[model samples]
Target: MLSRREIESYESQGYLHIPAVFTGRDICEMERDHEFMTRHWASSGQGWTGPWRKEYMDAATEKQSQLVAMHDLHFYAASWMQAVTHPRLVEAMGDLLGPNVELHHSTMHTKPPETGHPFPMHQDWAFYQHQDGRYVDVLVHLDDTRHENGEIRFLAGSHAQGALEHITCTPEGPCTPHLPTANYHLKETIPVPARRGDVVCFNIFTVHGSYVNRTSQPRRLVRLGYRDPENPQLGGQSHGRPGLMVRGHRPNPGGLHPAYSSEVGALDAFKAVPEPALVG
Candidate 1:
C-alpha cells in the first residue's frame, strides 16, 4: 500500500501521511459507531477509572458534550474492529513492522469544539518501551483536521536518536518526556493537517503532540498501533490491553498475551472478505 518513496520517508523522517486511504462510506460508519459508543457510555453512568478517562469524562460532562476520547474500542465495537483491521492499513503496517504484525491497541480521540484538551509534546515510547523501536502508530482522521482544530505536530527525524528522559508533572496526569524549547536542533516542527479519510503513520519514538481545538466543530480521529510479535514488553509491564493478530501468523508462542476469542471475533468478517483495491 506504500510506495518506496513513502516507505523511505517514514524511515528517514519518522512519519508519513497518506491522504484518502479510507472512503467516505468508511468515515460515515466510524462516525456513527463513535456516536453510539458515546451515548452508551453516558447512559451507563459508569464511573471513570484511569486518569485519561477521568479527565475526558469530567470535561465532557462539564461541557454537556460527548466523551473526548476512548481506548480499546476495537475489543467492543465491530465497526472499530473492521476499521483497525482494514486491509490497506494492515498492508501499510506490514511494510513497517514486517509481515507478522499485531494490533497493540486502538483509541478514538474526539476533540469537541472549544474545550478540547491539549496533549503536551511527548514520545509514545515513554508509555510503552520495547526492546527494539519497531512499534508504529497510525492516526486515521474522521474529520478535517487543521491547525485551528488541534492538528498533530511532529519533530522531524527525532525517532532515530532513541528515547529521552521524561518528567512527571502530576501523579494523576500523564508523564511526558521534556525537551528543551531552546537550542533544540530540530526546532522547526512539522504540522500535519489532514482531511477526512486521511491517515498519518509515525514511529513510536517520534516526538508529537497536538494543541487545543479552537474551532466550533469537533476534531475526530482514531489511532491504531502495530508492532512486531517478536518485540516483547520489557519487565512484563502492560501498555494497554491484550492485542489481536491482524496480519500474518505469530511465530513467537509467548509473544502476545492470551485473550477471549469473543474479544476479537468481530475481526473474522474482515479477514473473510476479499481485499479491496487501494484508494487514492
Candidate 2:
C-alpha cells in the first residue's frame, strides 16, 4: 500500500497524495453512480446554504455557488462500498493508523462546474474530533483536479500543532468550521493537484482548504475518514457510533467504548427491567 518513506512523509508532513490507487474504468463507474445517487437527493436542498456561506461567496457568486454531497455512499451504492473497502485503501489505512483501523464515516465532496464553491481553510478536527491524533481523512478522486479547478491545499506540518480552535459557523456547509480569514490565507497553503484514481490522505488536524472550481468539469472527490480502533471521539459527527473496522478487528480496551455501548447498555437495561411476561 505504502512504503516506509511514504509513511514517514505522511507522519512528518501530515499529508500524502498517492496517485492512481484505483483503476480508471472502476472509478468512472463509481462516478457515474455518483450522478445516479445525486438525482435521488435533488430538490432536497442539498446544496450549500446558510448565513456562513456568504463568507466564501460574494452576492453574484453566492447566487451561482453550489456543492453537491451526501454521507455514507456505501449504504446506497455497491460500487462505492467496494471502492472504499478496496484492498489497497484499507491496507493503506493499516499502514498509517495501525493494524486495527476503523472507518469513522464517508461523504460526497463533488464540486460541479463553474459554480462550484470553495472550502475555507480549516481542520477536519473541528467537524469530527477525536481524543488523539491517530486518525486520517482520505479523498478518493474520481476526476482530475488542478489549481484552476480548486484542488485541495494543505499547510504542511500544521497537524503537528494538534487541533486548533476553528471559527464555528452554521451547522453545516464547506466552512462550517473554517479558520478566520484575517490570519489563515488560502494562498499560504500548498495546492495538491491530483488525477483520476488518485487518493489524497491527510491528518484530520491538518489545515486545509481549496479555491473555487472555475472549470466547466466537475471536481469529484469522495471523503473516507479512518482511525485506529483505540482513538475515541470526544464529541462530533457520528459520535458514539463504532463504525466499520477496515483492517483488523476493533480492539476492546474495556470502559464504555462506543463499540460496547449498545451491547453493554442494552443487556444491563434488560437485566434491570426484567423480561416482560409473554403476551398474546
Candidate 3:
C-alpha cells in the first residue's frame, strides 16, 4: 500500500511508478519462460493454456510471427499473474477505487529489439466494457523503460471525465471527428521510466500510448487488469478466439492449478514457478 502522500501524488499526477517491483532474477526467469514458449510453441498445431492465457499471456500465440508484431498471450502463466496482481497493487487500487475488485484481464507486451510499431494514443475502457465507474490498470516493466525506447506517455487527469468521443487520427495529427473544436489537449506529457522490478499504475480512462521502439534492446512489460467484481461480462462475440474464466475465486485454494489466487506477499517476494522445458 502507498503512504497518504503517495496516494495524493497519484490523485494529483494521475499516475504512479513503484520502482523495483521485481528483481533482476525475476526478469531472467520470465524471459526464459518466454523464449521456451516461442521456440517450442507449434506454429501449426494446438495452442497454450492454463497459466498463460490472459492477454498478459492470457490468450495464445499465433502459429506464425507477423511483420512488426510477435505477440504471445499468457506467456508467463500464473506466476506472472502473481507479479501482476501483487498485494501492494491490489491495496493501491483498493485505496484509489474500492475493495470489490476482480482480475479483469492481463497481457504481456514485448517490443523486440529493432522491431516494434507505435501504439496509437487512445482510452482503454472506451474499447473494453466496464459497468463500474472506476477501473485500474498496472504495467510492470521487465526492463529499463525510456522515451527513446518507446515508453508509455499519457495525458494526466483525463480519467476524471468519461470517454472523449470520436477522437480520430489524421495526417496533420490526432483530432476529434465532431464538434466545433477539440477539447483534447495534452495537460502533461511524461515518459514513464522504470527498472526491471518497477510497476506503473494508471486509470482506465486516461489517454495514453507508446511510440515505436528505436533502441536495440527488447522492451517488455506485463499489463495486469482489475475491475469491480460485480461488473458482468457484456454480451458480445470477440473477433479473435478468446479465453474465458471458467470459474474460480481469489486467494487461490491450491491444487497444482495456475489460475488459483493467493494472498499478496512481501514487496521483495518473487519466486519462479517451475515448468517443463519450453519445448515439449
Candidate 4:
C-alpha cells in the first residue's frame, strides 16, 4: 500500500516512481522471458501487428534483427501474464483505482542501443478514452532505464488540466498522432530514471515521451494498465483484445466481453483475442 504522501504526490504530480517493487529473483525471471520473446519474434520474422508495425518492420529489415516492441504480451507468454497480474502491482493499483480494477492492456517497449526510437510527447488518454479519465499505467522496468537509454520524461501536474488536443504528423512518412511540439514547451518536464525492478505509475492524462538511447545496452519496460470497472470506454474502442479482471469482483460483468471474463490467469491459450491496434 502507498503512504499518504506517496498517494498525494501521485494525485498532484500525475506520476510516482516506486523502487524495487519486484525482487531480484523476479526481475531475473522476467528478463529470461523477455529474451525468449525477443528471440522468437526476431527469428520468426513476425512483425508487430500494431500501429507502429510498419516502422518496426522497417527498422528490423534495415538492422537485420532488431526487436522494437511487442503488444499484448500477456496473451502470448505466461511470464508476462504473471508479471502484469502480480499481486504487488494489483495492490498498488487498488489504492488508486479502488477495489474493482480491471486490466486495460499490457505492452513491452524495447530501446536497443544507440539507434532506439523516440516517442513524441502525447497523452495515453488520447488513444484510450474513458469516462472521467479513470485510467492509470504501471510501467515495470525490466532493465535499468536512464536518460542515456531512453527513459520516459513527464510533464508534472499536466493531468489536472484534462485531455489536450493531439495532431497527426508524418515527420518520416508514417503518420502518428502526438501533441503539438509547442505544448511540450509549456510545462516543466522531468526525466524518470529507474532501476530494474522499479515500477513507475502515472495517470493516463499525463503528457510524456522519451529520447533516443545513446548507450550500448538495451532499455526495456513492461507497461500494464488498470482502470476502475465503473469507467467504461466513451469512444467504444476495444483494446482489440478483451481486458482481464485482475482484482475484486466486477458488479457489472456484462460490460466486459465474454472472452475477457472467461479467463482467470495466464491467457496463453486464448488464441482468439485480437492484436491491439495501437500501443496505447
Off by over 4 Å in 2: 42-55, 169-175, 255-280
CA lDDT of each candidate?
0.72, 0.81, 0.54, 0.73
Q: Give the better candidate number (1 or 3) by lDDT.
A: 1
Model 4 segments more than 4 A misplaced: 42-67, 169-174, 235-241, 253-280
Best by lDDT: 2
Q: Looking at candidate 1, what is the lDDT of residue 128?
A: 75
For model 1 the TM-score comes to 0.76
Best by TM-score: 2
Q: Per-residue lDDT of 97-166 in model 4, one digit per residue for the tens?
A: 8888889787777867765666667788876777775789889898888777778789999899897877
Candidate 4 CA-lDDT value: 0.73
Better of 2 and 3 by lDDT: 2
Q: Model 3: per-residue lDDT, tens digit, 1-280? A: 7778877877766677777666666667666765555456413222221111122121222222111212333443555545545566667767766655566566656665553444445566654645544667788776788876778877777667655664444455654232112343222457787777788888766777665566777787667666654453342222122332212333332322232224524321222335322332
What are the RMSDs of all candidates, in order?
9.0, 4.7, 12.8, 7.9
Candidates 1 and 3: which is better by TM-score?
1
Q: List the residue pairs that clash in candidate 2.
A: none
Q: Each model's TM-score? A: 0.76, 0.86, 0.63, 0.79
lDDT of 1 by residue, 97-155 (tens): 88888998887677777756555566777767777778898898988888888898898
Clashes of 2: 0
Return model 2's CA RMSD, one decimal. 4.7
Cα lDDT, model 2, residue 120: 81
